[model samples]
Target: MQPVQMTPAERAALERLVEHARGDTGQSRRVADFLLAWWNAGQCGSYDLTTAWGVDDTIMDDMCVVFRLASRANSYPETLGCGPQFEAIVRAWRPKLVE
Candidate 1:
């Protein structure tokens, strides 16, 4: 499949997300850290947030919220997360299941 062509704004947003997600600090940093650690550990299967990340459902939900906002930011510029960049990070660290 061909790659999606991102606008300047979208590209900028993606870069920002990559920076923050992989940064040394920030709320979403944990998400990136977990992803990296799990992937590096050869556990690239489905992620049961509560069991895998050792957090409760509430924290899992919050993490999902952060991911969703980042994924959907292209449609809603005011959102505080990265759009396609977040997707790229996830794809790199934890690819989706094949149906």
Candidate 2:
């Protein structure tokens, strides 16, 4: 598990991307949080996220694309979390299955 250690500037940049999801009335926020926590806690097998989160493989992959965008060193924060590119994965996220 690799921890994501970032400088203040990098943290701020991630926050900027996060802001796009605030009050978004979509799955963007939930998915964004899940991916952030996943990365911060060290990425698991991508399939682990799919079953645990109740999202199908294609949907999970879509979320990953947005997460990857926000994670890039020079990504434009405004370009993440919305628009046609994210239409499919931007709905309310399904809850984690309680076993």
Candidate 3:
């Protein structure tokens, strides 16, 4: 049997995401920002957010959901949330200290 995609469930998820992004001090906001940055980087960037959070499966899953919903929004964070949570998203791009 072919699998069916539930539109109602997705809509509910988007609504929840909307509420989550409304608050900045949450993983959803960071993930949204990270995903947007990845898209802006041609969707081929290798920042690997998974490693940033020590391969947290929940975060990776949220990333997928955010992408799925945002891709359908006309403005996404540009106007939806006023702006992105972070100015940019990078992996281990910080300066290292020398002993």
Best by the lDDT measure: 1
Give me the displacement of residue 34 in model 2, in angstroms.
Answer: 5.2
Q: Which residue pairs clash in candidate 3?
A: none
Model 2 is weakest, by summed lDDT over 10 consecutive residues, at 90-99
> What TM-score does prediction 3 earn?
0.38
Q: What TM-score does candidate 2 reach?
A: 0.29
Can you write out model 1's per-residue Cα lDDT over 1-99, one digit (the tens) per residue?
323345555455444445555544433555555444323335434434444354445545545554454354434322333345544555644556212
Clash totals for all candidate models? 0, 1, 0
**Runs in model 2 with CA error above 4 Å?**
1-52, 73-76, 79-99
How far residue 48's Cα lies from its native spot in candidate 1, in Å, is 9.5
| Collision pairs in model 1 | none
Model 3 residue 89 CA deviation in Å: 5.2
Q: Model 3, which residues run further than 4 Å from truth?
A: 1-33, 42-54, 82-84, 88-99
Tens-digit lDDT track for model 2 on 1-99?
333444555454445444443445434455455543433234211323443365445545555554554565333332333243222223322223211
Q: Which candidate is the best by TM-score?
A: 3
Candidate lDDT scores, in order, read: 0.45, 0.41, 0.44
